[model samples]
Target: MGKTVLVTGGNAGIGYFAAEQLAAAGATVVLGSRSDAKAAAALTSIRSRVPGARLSHVRLDLADLASLKTSVDALGVDSLDAVLCNAGVLVDGPERALTPDGHELMFATNHLGHFVLVCLLLPLLDASPAGRVVTTGSFVARSVKLDPADPQSANDYQSKRAYARSKLAQMLFGFELDRRLRAAGSTTISVVNHPGGALDSLTPSRPPVHVRGAGQRLRGLPAGLLLHGKDSGARPAVRAVLDPAVTGGQLIGPRVFGLRGKPRVEPVRGGAADPDLAAEIWAASVELTGMEPV
Candidate 1:
């Protein structure tokens, strides 16, 4: 039987490309999206790219913590080889938004929701021979520090800073999960990866899902040397989940100055490897989400 992988936000951008590559690799790719129309569109697009691709979809709204259990049950699989925690919300507006769960929008969707979802799926993940949880972090995470005390960003809520801090929290969670899994001697592993610099202008067209215009292609040419399309950006996460050589607790990203190139194993930077901070963040997550993965 082929491996089964669930990719959150697989309907578009980096997650979409990752799903396509995995499907082409013969895995059953389950695209997690909140919208039925978008999921159907993505399924068609992927099938167009890779004929006879095995695909499915589950209604997943990461920001709505109340609905995560229903979403997991909707996966309709007993075992999952991997869960790509790739769905995220980037709130760039000046006004800080909150999820239905009352947590910061970005933090809830990007970090806490994934955290709870993984916790609920632990049993299914453990059933696989080598189950893996791949967290999709960001390049911006490399510079920000997550304040465990203010994880929701209630005290200081700059849109950009809040977004960066949420990604940082996710990276910390990934590393800390690896540590916990190792301590428990589980076969499952956790890995963190970041897409260096992915832009729509640089991305190739995937009709019905994504279509880059001629003007966009021309505008993206100059940055091509240093920036890449979302397709290239999807590589590190795909490598982390599918590559046998990738072990737990490792950070992976682009090879060239962490900007744009082939995916490679990179050092964990920006306090992502700090165990104390990770533990603190882990505690905060548990408190905020009422879920724990161990």
Candidate 2:
């Protein structure tokens, strides 16, 4: 039997491709998404690509904390071999939208929601011999200046900054999680990976959203000369979950300038390695989520 795995935002983009890779390698994937229709469509898409793929969908809304609990409860699995915290928000509608739980939308969806989910699912992860959690991050995280004073980014409210802060939170949390797991003598590894500038514009996904391939390729050539499509970007996260060599807390990204290349161990930057900041972020997440993971 294949290992049981779960992936957030598995309905599209890198998450969708990562699910395909995992399912193709023999695993039962419990996909989580906000939309049932999208999840269903994604399942069909995956099945078309990988025949006999074991897949299921769970309705999850990061904006709604109650829904998150209910969604996990719906899954009766006692243990999960791996979980990819792949769901996130980038080009959201509102400039500074807040979740139903009163937290910043991007911060909640990209970081806090995944944080709570991982903590809640620790038992299931512990049940596996070598459980893993891989959180999706981005090169944008390198520029974030996450301030505890403005955790919500309500005052500044720059869309790109908000998104960057959220991504940085995911990276910090991933490292912090591994630290805590080690401190507690657990084997479950928590790692983070970036899709290497995996722009939707360059990828040809079904139902095609944002067809800016030629333009993005031309425009991004200076910064991301070889920017990856989504499938290529998903490779690093998949490796983080499946690779035995990937130790806990290690950062991973595309080798070629983090735009388009093979997955490789990369250095953490932009104050992301500060232990004090990680603890602060953890405390903030726990307070925001209203619960600490066991």
Candidate 3:
């Protein structure tokens, strides 16, 4: 119970599984969710699986700036070994929804909220011995182009395109974080992971019609036979946070299609390899979230 770890959106899906695995490994797992009931449910589920699991629940809503700060306040301020930014949402409707802070929903929840949380906790993290931050990205990062001038996709918002763009931001943040922290003489590791395509049905939103297309149908075999399990998808994330072999800027995931095979440290996409774009995204994120780098 000494090494502290927090997982945003850890109440369900891949986040829940990651928390469970980390708990089983004897780390204090704090499940962050907007719903207290769901957070309790997640804690109970983890205990049912691992009787000795050290777990707790805290409120965290990525869509609301005040909620983010409130959740950060509720968390016990202590040196954290790692913070897994796994909370994300895929808003697939035609209408563009703005967050409480008046930012795009997908971008705010998937990227900015975690960005704020990481920055707020960076002081505690930097004070720890070998603290780390791990962010969950997606294979969709390959499909989008990051235009700094139009970071929010305000002019054109295609549902799937918006989702892809958010993922790209996630990857960009990971790379830029590593570069900046190293330059600042902080050893905090910033690593990224993608689940490829896993069968995670915990999200409350529906996928856009086009997103539920032929690929999903062809791969509609069996959850076990086709898509990777949440545990399998979370392997790279687990390694990134826990394994000493893992390093900053390393991308981890399965080797096979949709990354369903064994997990390993991998390289991110080339388009997401722009240092300049990453820096711009970092600055934008700080401004958007009102979070200062610690």
User: lDDT of each structure?
Assistant: 0.92, 0.84, 0.80
Positional deviation of 118 in candidate 2, in angstroms? 1.0
User: Model 2, 1-294: lDDT tens per residue?
Assistant: 488889999988888888989999888998899888889888988898889999999998876776777888888898899999999887555567877678888888888889888877888899999899898888888887888767779888888889999988888899888899999999798988888888665565555322455676666556446786788899999888888899999888999987788999999877578878888988988887788774
Please give the distance, in angstroms, between residue 4's alpha carbon in candidate 2 and its true position after superposition. Answer: 1.3
Better model by TM-score, 2 or 3?
2
Runs in model 2 lying further than 4 Å from the true structure: 91-94, 207-224
Give candidates' CA RMSD values in order: 0.9, 2.4, 4.8
Off by over 4 Å in 1: none
Q: Which runs of model 3 end up more than 4 angstroms from their true locations?
A: 200-226
Better of 1 and 3 by lDDT: 1
For model 3 the TM-score comes to 0.90
Question: lDDT by residue for model 3 over 1-294, one digit each (tens)?
Answer: 356788988887778878878998889988889998888877877887888888988888887766666787788766889999999998878999898678999998898888888888888789788999999999888978978777889999887898888988988898889888998999798999887677643212122201234555445555556566566677777777888888898888887764587778776666678888888888888777777564
Clashes of each: 0, 0, 0
TM-score for each model: 0.98, 0.92, 0.90
Best first by lDDT, ranked: 1, 2, 3
